[model samples]
Every structure is written in C-alpha cells, then in structure tokens.
Target: MDLQKQLNEDMKQAMKNREKQRLVVIRSVKSALQNEQINKGSDLTEEEVLTVLNREMKQRKESLHEFENANRDDLVAKVEAEMDVLHTYLPEQLSDEELQKIVDETIAETGASSKAEMGKVMGAIMPKVKGKADGGQVNRLVLQSLS
Candidate 1:
C-alpha cells in the first residue's frame, strides 16, 4: 500500500490498540501530507510523500537535539519516541560506506574536483539518493569526498 493508505491503516490500528504516541505521530504526518497536497493543488506522488515524511522526521530530530541540549530528559524521550514512529515510514537509510561510494561516483560523473563544484555534485547525487538518505548526512559525505 502507498504511504497514506499505510498510515491510515496504522492509525486505525493504533486507535484500536490504544497506542497514543503512535496514533498522534501518524495523525501528525497525515496532516502534513494533506496540507502539502492542498498547497500543491494535486495529489502527492510517492516521491512528494517521502519528501513530507523526511521533513517531519527532520523536525523531530531537531527537537530531539534541542531537548538533549537543554537537559530535558522527558522531552528527549518523547521526541525519540516520535522519531521512531516517523522512521517506520521512511525507506531504509543508506550506510556511510554506500553513501560515500555514491558521492565518489557522482563526483566523477560531474567532474567535480573541488569544493567549488560541490553544488554540481550535490545536484547530480540528490535525486539518486533521495528519501533513502538524510540530506545533512549526504552533504557531509559529499564535502568529505570533495575535500
């Protein structure tokens, strides 16, 4: 099933099981997806849905970091749980070695020999890794490879 359908099914299951945290996360993602669809004035493609999922995951991660920094153990645990819920919808993440290999290959393909050509390398590689990798992680790998 597609993400929206899967989420809807999961939401119902969560409700049935009284899984409040999971239910809340699912509802939040569904809302974000619906808003994006409305803004675009069309149904979201799989890729677009992934983009929204990734964005929500990223926000949760940022919140996790902030909570950790502020020593708010309660909030940190809550955010971590939310992230876990969100992660279930994302594609399996790329490993460091795999990401590096792709970065090296894209560099060669783009003939990007210096950091100045980082934009070229990023542009060529992102589509290939989209939704399967975090943009920040990919950017770090690309920078390391270029440097």
Candidate 2:
C-alpha cells in the first residue's frame, strides 16, 4: 500500500487499540503529509513521502536532543517513541563503513580532489544515498575523506 493509505490504516488500528501515543504521532505525520500535498498542489510520490518522513524524523531527533539537554527525560522518552515510529517507515540506513565506501566511490566518480569540491561530491552522492543515509553524516564523511 502507498504510504498515505498505510498511514490511514495504521491510524485506524491505533484508535481501535486505544494507543494514544501512536495515534498522536500518526496524526502528526498525516497532518504533515496532507499539508505537503496542499502546498505542492499535487499528490506526493513515494520519494516525496519518504522525504517528508525523513524531515519529521529529523525534527524529532533534534527535539529529543534538546529535551535531553534540558533534563526533560519524560519529553525525551515521548519523542524517542515517536522517532521509533517514524523510523519504521524509512529505508534502512547505511552503516558507517558502507557510507564511507559510497562516499569514496562518489568522490572518485566526480573527480573530487579536495574540500573545495565538497559540493560537487555531495551533489553527485546525495541522490544515491537519499532516504538511505543521513545527509549531514554523508557530508561529514565526504569532507573527512577529501580533507
């Protein structure tokens, strides 16, 4: 099933199971997807849906970090739970070694020689890694390898 339909089905199940936390996170995801559709004036592709999911997951991670820093363990737990739900819908992430291999390949493919070519390497690599790896992590690895 497409993400939208799957989310709807899951939302129904959450309501049936009286899973308040799951329901809340699912509703938030649904709202974000709907808002994107309205803003773009078209339906979202699977890739677009994945992008939205990634953005939501990233936001939750940032919020979790801030909550932890503030010693708000309760809030951190809630956000972490939401993050777990979000991760279920994303593609499997690449391991550090795998990411490094891909970065090396991309750098070679783009003939990138130094940090100055970071953008070129990133542009070449992101499409290959998108939805499978974190962009920030990929960028950092690329810079490290190049430098």
Candidate 3:
C-alpha cells in the first residue's frame, strides 16, 4: 500500500511530537493495513486502504454518538480525537449537492421510477460514488428521489 509510506511518515512525526493519541491511531491504522495485506496476500491499492480507514472512521463516529447519548463525555472525547486523526487520511467527503447530483444522474441512468426499484438504483449508484460519498447519505437521497 503506497499510503503506508505516508502513514509511516506521519507516525514518525507524531512520535517525535510525543502525541500519544495521534500515534495510537496511526499505529492502529498500520496494523489494520498489515492485516488487510495478509488477508489479500498482496499489497492493497490506495482505494482498498481507504476502505479500511473509512470503516474505522465510521466506527468511531458511531461510538461517539452512543457515548454522547449515554452521557459518557470522557469516552466521547476519546472517540472524537481518534476520528480527527482518521479524517486526515480519508478522502474529502462529497458535498450534499454533489452527492445529490450523482444520485439524480444514477436514477436517470438506471431508469428507477419508484420506491420498489430502490435496489436497482443503489446497485448502479454505489460503484459511481464509492469512496467519494457515504453509503448512508446516498441511500437517504435515493429514497427521497424514489418516493
């Protein structure tokens, strides 16, 4: 994974600065990447590495939400910190407008006219927006369009 080099550099910088939380996150990312490499039996492409980072970020966000609801300020803070570090590696998220346009275009392309055709629309849209947009966001917008 080419991004592995960048992660190594960032980890070195974090270690030099004595940033414990940041270093932990970076190390976890490295560990995840290594595991993925072993599973695939080859180095991952940048996109595949991104899929791992994105999954980590999503998990952090969900934990943050649960912590907030449970009044666990301390855990919420930790999750948010981890999320901030992970965000640096993730691709810039698409704007709502941009995502909506893609959904509209996909709807047009797939000829999905009603809610029942949601699967077909999603099948066509996910590949177009993969890694560029969140699946949840695309699902919501597609639901709106079909409804």
Q: Each prediction's Cα lDDT score?
A: 0.94, 0.93, 0.91
Which pairs, if any, clash in model 3?
Answer: none
**Candidate 2 lDDT, 30-70, residue by residue in tens:** 99999999999999999999999999999998999899999
> Which candidate number maximizes lDDT?
1
Strongest candidate by TM-score: 1
Q: Write the per-residue lDDT of candidate 3 for residues 75-102, one digit (tens) a residue.
A: 9999999999988888788999999999
Span of ten consecutive residues with least summed lDDT in model 3: 125-134
- Model 1 lDDT tens row, 21-40: 99999999999999999999
Query: Any runs in candidate 1 off by more than 4 Å, and if so which?
Result: none
Q: Output the better candidate (1/3) by lDDT.
A: 1
What ranking emerges by TM-score with the best candidate at the front? 1, 2, 3
TM-score of 2: 0.97
Prediction 2 global C-alpha lDDT: 0.93
- Clashing pairs for model 2 are none
What TM-score goes with each of the models?
Answer: 0.98, 0.97, 0.95
After the best TM-score superposition of candidate 1, give how far the Cα of residue 90 lies from its true spot, in angstroms.
0.4
